[model samples]
Target: TQASYETTSVYGHGHPLYYNNVINCLRGEAEPETDGREGLKSLELLIAMYLSARDGRRVSLPLEY
Candidate 1:
């Protein structure tokens, strides 16, 4: 058995909506709903994944620097 995915957009996914929002922001029509802080956190997590995979060990967030 299987199940359908969940979403709020009529277009099935968020990419197009995200792009449109970016364009609107660039045109000074809308404010960002989110910011680079989250993106930086995500990048940190990705770096942790790479480190753990390379070293074969558990990794922690806000990785020691």
Candidate 2:
């Protein structure tokens, strides 16, 4: 995932500084806040987005669809 992020930041966007800035803002490249906790939250958020998209419903956070 990190490698893909790196590649996309460079090739897809063609702007490493801007991409890195966004990455840093989003905490993607930083160490996890509490082991797998932050990761689990991200996965849940992603799944909620996918579900909302598939069902054509609005999903709100803390994630209500």
Query: Against the true structure, whose lDDT is highest?
Result: 1
Evaluated at residue 15, the lDDT of candidate 2 is 52
lDDT of candidate 2 over 1-65, digit per residue (tens):
34444453334654565556567758766542344676578778998899899999987767543
Instruction: Tell me the deviation in Å of residue 50 in model 1.
Output: 1.2
Clash pairs for candidate 2: none
Best by TM-score: 1
Q: Name the Cα RMSD for model 2.
A: 10.1
Runs of candidate 2 with Cα error greater than 4 angstroms are: 1-34, 63-65
